[model samples]
Target chain A: MSTWNMITFQDSNSLYSDNLISFHDFIMLFIIMIISLTLFFIVDLMLNKFMNLLLLKNHMIEIIWTLIPMFILMMICYPSLKILYFIDEMFNPYFSIKAIGHQWYWSYEYPEFNNYEINCYMNNYMNKNQFRLLETDNRLIIPFKISLRLLVSSVDVIHSWTIQSLGIKVDAVPGRINQLNLFSIRPGLFFGQCSEICGINHSFMPIMLESTSYFNFINWMNNNNN
Target chain B: MVKYTQLGNATTLETPADLKPKTAPYDPRFPNQNQTRYCYTSYLDFHRCKKRHSEEYEACKYFKKVYTAMCPLAWTTNWDEQIENGNFPGDI
Candidate 1:
């Protein structure tokens, strides 16, 4: 049995979770920036009081504030650009799934598995027992500990496929395909909703992904086909 | 295995609040199944839903069939309940 660690951001059963070094790096940089900005503000406040004294007549505080922010911005920009490029670079994937977005629903296709396809649409009118907008007829099932490539596209309008737990979010454009690298850590259910406002029913486009062991995943794929 | 949501009593299913509305097709007064005539030029809204006319239904049916063949298990709809609820099958 695997122990669950909430302190870590690593997903339950994934390989690309290790590749998420850039996101963490940017987060650390962001924290440093906040601290630097806070200190700069404090120093500016002190210097403002000090400058009130006619004896010390220098434009030093203004220069420091301008230069410090520029330095901080440069620091933030470099890592931000690097992370964007790294995420865009597509590595060889173990498996791929094509996700299609409609007005208020999502459809998925596994081309490699005899074109096994699944349509997962949210049921808005959940009878007394069902989850509203968050419930779908079919859930996306993937294996833990494998690199999965997601190809996202839309049929009608633009939408965003986002699943924070897996740290995956990609845009679904009408005529173009957007690719995303996703991998999950463990065998459990995780949920997310459409990040973009596509239509009135946009809120109804909920996503449910379940990660399982490689063997169990294979069994699921087979069962789905049968 | 599928279940509906229970009300505050936690034992009864919450029926739709509007037991019947003006849009209810079950009302015999408007049995012709009235729908708005939507012009393509005027229909560019976010939730713009296109309704095919009788003549266009043939082409729409072909497209639906092709789509279903492309993705079999995903296209089927529950017809009986949908009909009772005044919802069109394969509308999307």
Candidate 2:
């Protein structure tokens, strides 16, 4: 029996994969961090060193400092805008999942699979011996190496479906369906939870996704067929 | 809430007086009764069990017992795995 403190390592074939958008986002963050850190020290040192060298009564230095930040902001915004447009440009999706958020849980439907649907709720016990809230009764399994489209929405209130490994987070708003794309490079289990506060059991709406090879996925789907 | 006795088992809620059926010999194995059922606690706990076991049906009885021991809302589990796999004698 596994002890409470022992962490179960993930299987060898993991699901994580690199994507262009995430790489760009990381680069942008890195640039912003470097600029902020350097500017912070530079500004502090300059303020002390040149306190009396520059004009004391004029406010031009403050204006220059303000415009410099605005210029940096433009540099950050342009790339972010371009990436948003790129992600929004759609193409043919291999498979789609309809996730409907409810009061205390989430329900998912696969229209291709005879409209099969299942409700998922969270189990929050943290005794490593027990499954934590990260696990769900019926995981939304998908095939690896294929782009999967997710249609997210809500039935009662607003919620957000977010998975850190996939780097995808979208709002589940009532009366609106938002779509996102995901493709795992390999086979493994990915866990997520409700990122938005909807109701009393907002913390209970956990999501579990299992990705497998195309052949294994088809076999698993056939086995789970109604 | 009024309690009802069916097959020597006392239920939490009473049966509707107008819909009462004729009394018959009490069977310990299967007790047929009409009563208000509480399902919330049972459903959530069974859901917890499915997550822990990844939908393995052999542990349904053990999970059901755990659910009942915890609270009255232990009725939400569909027990589909056990029904799909079929229950066998001496199976836990």
DockQ score of each predicted structure, in the order shown: 0.02, 0.01
Q: Candidate 1: misplaced stretches above 4 Å? A: A1-63, A124-132, B1-92
Please, what are the lDDT tens digits per residue for candidate 1 over residues A68-150? 87887786666456545555554445556778898888988775566677889886564978656677889998876565667
The top-ranked prediction according to DockQ is 1
> Residues B39-78, candidate 2, lDDT per residue (tens digit)?
2234344556676775566665444543332221111123
How does residue A195 of candidate 1 score in lDDT?
87
Name the runs in model 2 displaced over 4 angstroms: A1-71, A124-127, B1-92
| Docking level for model 1 | incorrect
Q: Candidate 2, overall lDDT?
A: 0.56
The candidate that achieves the highest lDDT relative to the unseen native structure: 1
Task: State the fnat of model 2.
Answer: 0.00
**RMSD to the native, candidate 2?**
22.2
Worst 10 residues of 1 chain B by lDDT: B1-10
Question: TM-score for each prediction?
Answer: 0.57, 0.56
